[model samples]
Target: MVDEFLKWYFSQRPVLASQLGADGHDHTLGDFSAAGLTAREREEECWLDRLSRTETPTLDDAIDRDLVLSHLRGSIAMQSWPEWRRDPSAYLGPVFASMFNPFQQRLKPEPELVAAAISRLAEVPAVLAACRANLDPDLAAPLLVQRGLGQARTGRNFLTRTVPSMVEDPDLRARLAAAAEPAAAAFDDLVTFLEGFTCGGTWRMGEKLYSTLLRERELLGYGAAELHEKGRAAWAELDARMREVALRVNGTQDWRAAMETLMDDHPPTLEDMRAEYEAETLRARDFVRERELVTFPEGEECQVLPSAEYARPILAVAHYLAPPPLSSSRTGVFFVPYTPDGFTPEQVRQRLRTNCRAQMPSIAVHEAYPGHHWHLSYLAAGSRTARKVFRTPYFTEGWALYVEKMLHEQGYFDTPATELAHLDCRIFRAARIVVDTALHCEDMSIEQAEEFMATRASLSPGTAQGEVNRYCAWPTQAPSYLTGAIEIERIKESFTGTPREFHDRIAGSGGLPLGLAEQAALA
Candidate 1:
């Protein structure tokens, strides 16, 4: 049915016709062949290439208008819904992505746009410098020129360029401007949001579009209190079980010491880390193929790559590949950081310990098993273009969260101490859920949120507060980690029969939405 609709839509829309102007500003498919086509060419070609492979039978104008309008309506409806009673801190995530992910701000010549943006080789350095400086009027402050990103001149300039493209119609403009007031007012409530980094640049003020964004990022329509409660209950259970296992593994010794001893017994050298990763990737591939766990189409293969700079920070422990363009054959990359400061000789040597060895297997499962790495690979294999192009954060983060603790029972983290670390992460994520709810809707202070995380999760004060700051700046995201995990857990437990059958049940079908994860497991 969808394919039939798509075919009809394609004929009506004639995306190619829309691109060409009536004045016959001739866009020669081959005329400027040597100089290469412009930016418009690249975008058109990218879309065309994707469409050509769709296997849709026909193209109709009604379908074209419907597709474009449907997407646009989804956007405008979020902003204009009256008495929507939505949260303010959750708005405009995709809007944020469009602004930050690449360059689209300025009127660059067609050929240089996306490439210029991705390289970050444009005047971004100057912009970063300016944003970090002690300027007279901060970008966070309300002003006529506050239409872009931060201090980075190029970043801000690019944001300005990109935003207009998403929202340009005059009627929609008047409605957006009118609806924006409440959201902007909500921003004033999140004071720490403005005092972002030590360098004086402001974080993205996406909290202004909080309501719609929250709905979009989170798959369900649940309230904050419900999410907070679910996370807290799950954390409590995981913590109790972890400590019990820790004591047993140490033969009644203290939990912390047991952890240290275990890590020392199974530590890996720096070189071993690389070899082990390659070994695991192959092992995972074999398991999927043998079990038929979501088939990867013939000729499709997943690859691993070294981490990049912007990604390196968050993925200090683990990372994965960025989506390649349609024409590219680059497989997904799984990256592990090798920072000398972080991975000292002593630290690397610790992996030789037995307990540490036990830990590596669980980490492997979290990174490569039925976890995100495999889930995404499955998605790509099934060719779910809409889900691929637009994935909800709840689903993405939830799948990863589910995989983290689930590895414990999978025979990966056998010893108790290593298991403690897994539980600790779960605890930290749980605290984030509470903090995410209280921080925004309940209007908790930074110190209060930090205190809650530190006490409940056993996190250092610095780590807790850093998390708090992230919540203040990012909003609603803190819950995604644990929220996703718990939902996955619920789905797993809801199964009526053996866990093996559960595994086989989900083997063929690709990733499912959180709302249906439980139902799918039962089916």
Candidate 2:
């Protein structure tokens, strides 16, 4: 039954199949190329109804049953929302991701790969047209539409400028260039259409729908109000700790000023950013190994790279891309965006402050060792196919955030300054919880969200705006970092074991929700 379901699921998401390094679906772009939105929703509903009525297989293991139930509920919950049909920005993810996937994992030969790219590029118009047809003009949010326009422009630039340079074959380059024109035109059409619409739609998910989403998608037993309260408590605790550290470092009560002091000690050049991150990643990995914090997979490697041009608009300063779970390779890519030459000296300095020397170690811990790269490597090695395919964002993101604090508690940072960096990240995530909930479940305006984040999270106005824009486009995802980490710490308190044992158990559980992880741990 599981096998049948997996096969059916992959068929519906061919782009996912490509990303997972699966074969037999390489030639086609799948549903993502031209997602039949209405039909897809109806199909999801039917599948959920069928799965709910079916008996659980007696032979299924405990983890399998947990995965199956979670997967079904999450899928149903996602389909229950009409975000994809309403928001044009939502469509941009799959469109760009499909184009980018072929370059990430090369399961095919050069000729076949180039051919695949060409084929996918040729289909871009049809995909955008379908997206246009699916999006409801009445339900479009202004902020989201504006963001979508920016993303569309980025995509167009990538197709024309970046992609052609990536291909060596002259014929393939010409074909790609030709295909880009129509795709770029389609994007222009989308922009013009969106510009004509008045901006009045709400991005708010509301309290009822938001709470239900948490229950179903995250498997959280708590309601929205409870989570918000927990987030507030976490924020207070972290804030107090940060102030204490700041007082020790600067001999003053001004924690934010101390943080600003650390930000000034950043890399001198944009080129140094990658080098700093790479060194810190190695240091973090070494610390984890010496402490025997968790088991490391053999031959697992991670590369630090500059963020692609198309991705810089939406990505944070640093982000990690794990190898596909089913891929033959276990190498992960950590991308950090370099400050462009077009920026003024002040702009460059401000941009580099995000990766200051004191903060690099904590960022390294969160993105690489004992964090996303390490966590994902374990899942790739030990997770079942079904478990790998279905993930809970709360668990995946939560585990990463939890490890940042875990490593600090183990005396990894060793200095008040470094510790402050870790605390700052915690506070930032906590702020995410408050702001994300407020933005989506309340009547908080975009400008208000930007200001709130800038003041509370110590983010610059530009950074806060970018963060708020992301929250607006992607409802509920921003808060998962804090919410997930809180759940993880709660689960950790219940287990009686060595730190290594606890860490291993959590990593070995794949990417199950905290509730499901607790159930599995106790079982």
Candidate 3:
């Protein structure tokens, strides 16, 4: 039954299937038309009903059934807040990924990859047409529309320039260009369509839906009210720590001033910044190995690269992309954003400061090394398809955040400066919980959220804006960093084992919800 459901599931989301290394769907895009969405929702309901009726005879079978049910429920719930009918930016993911995934993977032959890209590229117009037909400008969020414009523009640039430049074969290049021309035109049409919306609806998820998602979808065991309070408390604790470290770093209790002093000590160029990240990643991996902190999966490699043009708008500073679990390649890419074109000198400096030397170690450890790359490698190496496909932010993001603290405790910081940077990051995570909750459930205005982040989280105005926009788009995810880590820490209190043993047990639990992860880890 699970296998049957997965086959049908992957068929509906070809881009996701491709990303997971599932074959036969690389040349298609997801259906977002109203009828298509209706069909999808109906199919999901069918699966939910069927899965709920099945009897589990073993513990593993029961767990697998629960995972499938959880995924179905989440998918069904998301349809209620339909991005296809609202956010014009929603369609850009599969549209861009359709071409990007095929081109980036090293496993496929060049000819096969180019053929897939061309097939997907030819469908781009149809996908964008779906976006046009499905989207109601009256329901569109103005902020999301604005973001869509930037993304579409960048995506158009990619289709015309970056993608064409990536091709090498003369015949394939000509075919790619032939397909790309229409795809680029589709993007231009998308941009024009998006520009017509001068008014928009609310982006808020509201209290009831937000709370339901926390309890049901995420299985996080807490609602927005309680999570908001937890965030406040976490922020307060981290604030106090930051002040103490600030006094040590620069003889002052004002951490913001101390941060300024440290920001000045950074790499000079983007090349230098990328190099610094590469070096820190290697150093962190060496430290983890020397300490035997956790089990390392053999043959996994992490590479540092610049963020793609279209992706930089959302990625902000950096992000980690895990390799496809079903693929033969064991390579993950850590993308660091280059300074965007047309930025003022001050904006460019702010970008550099965010990726500054003092902050790079924590960022490196969080995005690579024993954080995402290391933790995901274990899950990828596992034999279960359900485990490889069903990931929750609570486990994935939480484990990454937890390891930052773990490494700090294991004497990985090496200097007071790095410690201060780590604490500042902790403050930001705490602040995320607060801001994310407020924006979604507490009726906080986007402007207010941006200000709160800029002042409380000590983020630059530009960075704060981007962060708040993300929070508005992705409800209930920002808090996972801290809240999930707290759950892991709670699980740790009763376990008496080596740090490596405990880490290995939980980190390999298939990205389950915190509650289920505890049960699986302790079992």
User: Highest TM-score among the candidates is held by which one?
Assistant: 3
* Model 2 per-residue lDDT at 290: 99
Error of 3 at 510 (Å): 1.4
RMSD in angstroms, candidate 3?
A: 1.3
Candidate 2 structure quality by residue, lDDT tens digits, 1-523: 5667678777877777777766766656555322465576667666666655666644225566557766777666666467666677666776677666576655566678777777776777776776677666667677777777767767767777677767677887787777777877777777676667565667777788788878876788876777777778888998888878898889986788988888899998877988989999999999999999999987788888887776766655678878788877678887876643345787667778877998899889988999999988878887478777777779888988899989988999899899888899889999888888887778577888898888777676777787888887777788888888878888889889988888888777778877778876555
How many clashing pairs does model 3 include? 0
Query: What are the RMSDs of all candidates, in order?
Result: 13.5, 2.3, 1.3
Candidate 2 lDDT = 0.77
- Candidate 3 lDDT, 1-523, residue by residue in tens: 8888899989888889989999888877777778987898899999999999999787767777788887788778778788888777668988887677566655688888888888888888988898888877677778777877888878677887788777888888877877788899999988887777575677888878788778876787778899899999999999888999998899999998888788888788777888899999999999999999999998999999887777877767688888898786678888887766667788777788888798999999999979999988878888778878888998888888899998999999978899999888888999999999999886588899999888887678888888898888778889989888888889988777999999888887788877778877788
Cα TM-score per model: 0.56, 0.94, 0.97
Tell me the whole-model lDDT of each prediction, alpha carbons only. Answer: 0.45, 0.77, 0.84
As a whole number from 0 to 100, the lDDT of residue 336 in candidate 1 is 50
Residues 1-523, candidate 1: write the lDDT tens digits.
3444333323322212112111121121111111221332343334444543444343332223223333333334333321111111112222233233222122233333333222222222322233223232433322212212221222222243332233445554344344333323333322223244222233332333444444433435566667667777877776677667777777653544555555564425544665666576676556545655343534444444433332222223555543332222324455654432334554345323322444555455555665556666555544333333334446566666666665555544455555776766666677787777776664566678888876776444544554565565555667877776666666777677655456545422334445534444565
